[model samples]
Target chain A: MLTIKNLHASIGGKEILKGIDLSIPAGQVHAIMGPNGSGKSTLSYILSDRAGYDVTEGSVTFKGRDLLSLNTEERAAAGVFLAMQYPVEIPGVSNMVFLKTALNAIRASRGQSPLDAMQTLKLLRGKASAIGLSEDMLKRAVNVGFSGGEKKRNEILQMAVLEPSLCILDETDSGLDIDALKIVADGVNALRSPERSMLVITHYQRLLDYIKPDAVHVLAYGKIRRSGGAELAHELEEKGYTDFVNEAA
Target chain B: MTLAAFITRSRREQEDWKYTDLEALLASTNKTFNLDTGFRRYDEDGDNRAYLLFLNGVWQSARSRFGSVPSCILMGDLESGYQLTLGEQTCLVAQPIEMVFETDSNAPAEIALKLSIDIGKNGRLTLLENHLPSNTITTIETDITLQSRAKFVHGKILASGTHLALHEVRVASGGYYNNFSLLRGGHPARNEINVTLEGEEAQAALNGIMLLRGSDHADTTTRITHQAPNCASRQVYKTVLDGKARGVFQGKITVAPHAQKSDGYQMSRALLLSDQAEMDARPELEIYADDVKCSHGSAIGALDEDAMFYLRARGLNETQARALLIESFVAETLDNVQVEAWRDIFRREIGEWAQ
Candidate 1:
């Protein structure tokens, strides 16, 4: 379970997420749709403890612990996963190595032994194939020279391997083709369970068609304007964000 | 015996005087530097060669070895006329002739030497220098002449206790020069290399890696010139600075006028371990040639936090994660080294240094 209470965030002294409150319980999927400059990405970044984002006034409690006190890596170890909109390209770092490190960090935090090389390879291979990535991609440097679809698939592969309690997919549908979208959606769907939760952040209803969310929220100017079921996504797709934009203004 | 006594005796006996300031530095240190000699001596065939030896920067000409006088090899092109062989294989011939320097000393001192090389038309040569000293300084100056199509490769390895060092090299027209320097030890050291590609179709590659710890200082500076058309040059240097050690890398590539189609690339990267450790990298490119591609980049940072966390999350402690990342950074440079045995040695040294 993740809870954000009256969260206010900004970057470079400019206010972005202005007093937003949201809560999601276990076993539910939530989709946050918003137009550009609506602070949708800012909320995800703040939760992930990314740099350059100042939490002016907010309290984020994940699994009953104060999430704001933890660093980025600590947040990840506490089962907070953020699929960044633009995944960083780290040259000379292999994807397998990167994933193994992340997974082991999380596992160690839970008092589990780190997987050995063979165990890591076996574990990564299965998840990679499930997410439609070839073994060659794992050997290459992380996100270096990767295509848009391949980068998204890599993110999903990471999510699958890490198996976080709460996954935040920030703009997971951006620049992905329909096939890549289905693969990403399937990755999310496979991880769905009674003990896990997901916040699927997107601007279009197309992604909602694949991974149906239990709840949908329209974010405008740093606050959730409306909350409804899957029907809200369909209505927004048909009506566009013009009404929400005017209302928020 | 102290270094002061050793230098005084050598100066009085040998009489090969040049730099008194270096001698004064040696006298001030007054430390008895000991080295295990009696390693297998390198073989030399009957050829014109210059053999030099320095103990704590004092030339030990008495113990040095030289071959028969070098003979000029006549070829079709004057610019490329000489061939220097390390056996039957053409070693590397941008400059003709070979010079070798060795030291066996017991004092913390510095050594500096110079050599001039001339290559004829279509000639090629290779110079291989190996330094295994005990607490000494080594400096070398080399001037090279290359005729058309002359090629040279200078391979050097500093395997042990050389406190400080510098190597300056100059290249002439229609020549290709490649230099590879590997540093393994010493408290504070430097390898300075300068190359001028004075001819068309001249190419150069300067690649090096320095792994240091324990208050060590390793500095590598290279200045490459593109003097003629179609000249190309590349430099890649990587350093691992741990403990309270420091590593410095300064590389500059210059393309002169009428050197059209000249291409140059320079990259320097460093990985810092402790807060006390330091790494400085400066890569510069200056071009006067209108038609050329020149770029330089320098990066200095601690190990990637994400990568480190990723490693830790997998099961490794913070120490293991840092070690793996440092090894990866230093091993990248060894990937280009040709010999597997040498690479193995480098890896072994790096592994020990990382720990």
Candidate 2:
């Protein structure tokens, strides 16, 4: 469902993601594990088509289309979702309104009639319970004054509602307690389907306990040094990234 | 032309009083006259109170009446005197002061009107002023004094025309004052207000909305001072400028020494609709008190591209999407208006301005 060929990206004139290549088939969850400053977040941002990231070289293709040619919203409409590490807090814009707008934007792009407020609310309520978010949270502004766990839950709720073809989870496990981590992982696991693909980016093996990945890739420096099964996550947790670091050096 | 001859021969002659060297602005337009010719004065015999009305910068003597001796002094250029005196427990409502200026000739003018009011202890006064200028210059100065426990609310709405205009207001001690200004037109307009909370427990709220179009310029400046303990002040101003218009907001909040527990908050936001449109926002807070909560923020931005795309992607055109966002921006000020009818009027005016 997604392909990357020598993906080289930089931000602010500083190259972050060096020449890298990866491919993931549909119906699979690939976890990218790396220590700090290993270009984990950079890859996710580049895939999401976020501004300020200069594609120095390489190319990314999603579902046989040139993903680099699309804007952020177009990428969003094309079923590419990125669960940001830090959700932006937009004041005065209620979460329900925001979600509805996003949903309608995607739907309209596919020539579908937009849902009304009532229909949107009904759809939101069903997903809110699935993500463990209360109705009150949906009524408030988007991510304003939300706890870390609540924000992650909100992101998952958006992902579930949008039902993107490809999902990129960028450090979703960071700052989450054990309970939040499990809920987030459960949410991701529930969304897994044969037609959907996920690229889970994390720093630890804890999140893998709930949503097991089909493949694990050790990203050191800017390139992937190793690719293994789910057990590789446990191995990295126990042995640390010392071997990868030494090999990269 | 002499000032007296100008006032007698033609009210439009005052349009030639040039403040700036905008010869094109002064000569390109016709002499503007006041549109509000027929104004019914409020009778003071029954439960209804008195209202002072001005038409085309000319104060109507016949409309000026007093239910009783007011506790306040009324002083201005068009009219000057002690209009009424409020008792310690009196409450006034539905008091409307309407002024209209219209013109048909190209000339510069300066029309100044000043009104002063003093509220007794524990008294409440509500003043509503609506200014409609065709194409002239109008300046209004309002001096207000509130005694201990006195409260006042002033609502000012300016719609259409008035080449250059200014509205100045000042508040005094232990008084709770609320001011709301809605600006929708004029080539260049200014609403300058200075408020002072001179006694303990004094409070003030200043809110404004400026919706400018064409090549208009709208400025809303507010200066609030907290001189006593336990005083609070809040100011919020929002502007939406389209075409080549310009919107400016300068808000300053000052907390004096020993004014402990003072709380001041100010926020200014502007939305530029066109590439040529401009907005300038300056929010300043000067606090000498140690125990105080003060914050000020200003933001100048164009319509949110993400929001625009979201709206447009949902079948709304670019204009419709832009109008929705601009309405939401200006509606923040109207949301704070206490009166429902007044808010409705403001909403209607804003809708017209947006279109």
Candidate 3:
């Protein structure tokens, strides 16, 4: 469902992502484990086409389409979802309204009729109930004064409501308690289907415990040095990234 | 010399009124066209309160609400324009009184209106005014008086025009006065508010929102005075400018020597949607009392790029994201509207402006 080939990206003329390659087929979940500054966040941002990032070289493809050429909104319409580590706190725009607007925009891009207010609320309620999000929270401004757990749950709620084809979880496990981790993981688990794919990006294996991945890749110094099964996460937690760091060298 | 001209040659031009060239504005608009309009017309199917309509400063009694209107509230037409006096035990809680004004013809002309409102002790009232877009030089002067323990809420919606609104207000002890204006740009429009807290324990709130684009111009100037002890006032104004449009805000506060324990706060924020857009803010505070507390804040900025990217990544296009963020910025001021239902009116207008 997603492919990154020889991915070399940088910001402000400083190279962060060295030449790298990774792939996740449909129906499978892949986890990228790396220490700080491994270009893990860079890869996720490049996939979503955030500004200020210069793609020095390499190409990224999503479902046979050249993802590098698509802008942020276009990539969103194409079902590229990135659960940001720090979701932007937007004042005045209610969480419910933002979700509805996003849902309708993606739907409109696909030539689907927009849902009315009632239908939109109903659909949001169905998805929100699963995450234990209250109606009041949805009515509040997007992520304004939200706790870390609440913000992550809000991201998962968006992922569930938008139902993007390829979900990129960029450090979704950071700042989450054990309970929040389980809730977010449950939200992700419920959406796992044969037609959907996920790339779980994390620094620890605890997140992988709930949303277990089909494969694990060790990323360090802007390159992926190892790829193995779920057991690789447990191994990294125990042995640390020392071996992976040496391999990159 | 005209008032606008005298201000044009002020010696203190550098300190205040530097950004807005009102003299040139009034000079730019001298020709006036006659509207040739008369009394008002309105439908009263669902609304129970009196509907007062005015065309080109003339009251239209034929089309306005009469049978349902309470006789005790209206003070009849006067040489100083219209008047409303609410005595004690009076309350318009059922619905806000609606006043509509329009021009008879589509002609650029100078229209002046005057209104005076007096609330007796402990009286409560909410007044709403709506003006249609008349591309002309229009001006209105309002005088407000609040008695002890009285509460008065004034909300206004203005359309595009060279509109100038001058408001003079006074609040007695235990009285509260709220003024909110939502302006839809202008060809150099301005609002000047003068408020005086006369007795102890008086309060006032002044808030407004301005949306401009395509070379439109707007200005909000205010002066507040605390005459007695334990008085307070607050001001919140937000403006959004796009294209080459410009917005200005000047807020001044004064605490008299005898006015101890006074509290005054002012917050002004503006959003420049494009590099060509501009916003100017000036806050002035003069304190004679040592026990008074007064502060003012102003902020002008463009839309947050990070917020923009976040919205787009969620599937909104550039236009949608920009509009949403702008709406959010102004919502801070909109939330301060005392009447909850009136908030929807502002929201609907904001949505239309966005479109």
Candidate 4:
């Protein structure tokens, strides 16, 4: 469902990702584990077409289309979703309004009719309750005064509502407690299916306990240093990325 | 001497008139417009509330559905304007009261209207002032005396096509005054309000929103004086400027020595959508009381780029994302309006402008 061929990206004249090569077929979940500044998040941002990231070389293709050619909103409408590490707080736009607008925009791009307010609210309530978000929280401003766990869960709610084919989770486990981690993992686990693909980016192996990845790749020095089975995550958690960083250097 | 002549001879370079060119504005004011008694345009009061309708500086009609006559002309100025009074000693069960002034002229004239209101002890009143004009200049002054425990709310809406507008307000002893304004700028406009807390335990709040586009210019100036003990005041102003529009906010709060327990806060925020749009904010606090709490802050910037990107990543187009942020920025000030009907009308106008 997604392909990257030596994707070299940079920002502000400094290169971040150097020769990143990975491909995730439909129905498979891939994990990218790396240390700080190892280009794991950079890869996710580049795939989502975030501004300020210049692609100096290579290319990214999603579902047989040139993903890099689309803008940020277009990329989102084409079924590419990136769950950010730190969700931005929009002080006055309610969470419910944000979700409805996003859902309708994506649907419109795919030739679907817009949903009425009642229909949108009904769908949102059903999906929100499953993730432990109350109706009041949905009515509040997006991520305003929300706890760290609530923000992460809101990101997952967006992912579920949009139902993107390709999901990119960037450090979703960084600020979550054990209970929050379980809830977020459970939300992700329920959305796994044969036609959808996920690229989970993290530095820790704790999240893998609930939502296991099909394959694990160790990223260092802007490149994938190792690719192995699910055990690779556990091995790295026990050994850390020190040896991998030194080897890549 | 008439007030206009006295104002013309006043020093133009004083601290209060530094940002505003008052001399030039007065020099250009020559023509005078008579009151239009033709009620064909504003015959309907829009809502079923007691209202006072004024067209081109003349009182057209006054209707009361709840309380006695809201306005009584105590006296008249020598050259122009009237000293009208409003409200009495008791709270009225009537609907919201509206004072609407409208003009549809492109002539170079100055329309001056003065109002003096005395709210009796423990009385309550809600007044909504609507300014709907077409390329006209206006100067308005209102003096208010509130007895102990009295409450007053002043809501004003400045719609499009107004050339210039100036307003001054003064509040007295043990009174609570709340003033809210929503201004849409299609031409140059100005609003200057001065409030003095003369009695102990008096409270005042000033909040306004300015929406400007094209070459529109609008200025809002407020000076609040806390003279008695235990008084509090708050001022918040928000502006959204697009195109090559310009906005100015000059707010000052002063606390006297007798007002030792006073609390004052002032905040001015502006959102500049286009690179050429401009916003100038001057916030001042002069305090003689050592035991007072006073703070002022100003913020001016474009929409947060990261926030914009986040919204776009969620599938909103650039215009849609920008409109949402701008509306929210302006709505923060509108949320403080206490009247439901006024709030609804302001919301509708904001929605139309965003579109």
- Per-residue C-alpha lDDT of model 1 across residues B207-272, encoded as one tens digit per residue: 887877765666687888888888888888888777877777878788888889998989898877
Evaluated with lDDT, which candidate comes out highest?
3
For model 3, residues B1-355, the per-residue Cα lDDT tens digits are: 2244335444456455577777676566543323333212223245455667776656667756744457445555524578888878677756687777777664335666778888999999888887766655667778899999899999888877677777899999999999999888776777888999999999999999999998788888899999999999999999999998889999999999999999999999998888999898989999999998899999988789989999999999999998899889988888899887789778878887886
CAPRI grade, predicted model 4: medium
Which numbered prediction scores highest in DockQ against the true structure? 3
TM-scores, in order shown? 0.68, 0.71, 0.93, 0.89
TM-score for candidate 1, please give it: 0.68
Instruction: Name the better of 1 and 4 by DockQ.
Output: 4
Expressed as tens digits, the lDDT of each residue in B1-355 for candidate 4 is 2236336633643675565555654454443333354122222645466666666767665432323544442345413555544446666435667667776563345666666667777788787777764445566666677777788888887765433444444455678889998887734566777888888889999999999887677788898999998999988899999998888899999999879999999999999999999899999999999999999999998999888889999998888788778867876777788887777778766766766
Model 4 iRMS (Å) reads 0.9
Q: Put the candidates in TM-score order, highest first.
A: 3, 4, 2, 1
* Each candidate structure's count of clashing pairs: 36, 25, 2, 0
Where is model 2 chain A poorest over a 10-residue stretch in terms of lDDT? A85-94
Q: What is the TM-score of chain A alone in each candidate?
A: 0.98, 0.98, 0.98, 0.99
For model 1, the DockQ equals: 0.12
lDDT of each: 0.71, 0.75, 0.86, 0.81
Clash pairs for candidate 3 = B39-B60, B40-B60
lDDT of 1 by residue, A152-246 (tens): 88888888998888989999999999998998888889989998999999999999999999999999988899999999999999999999899
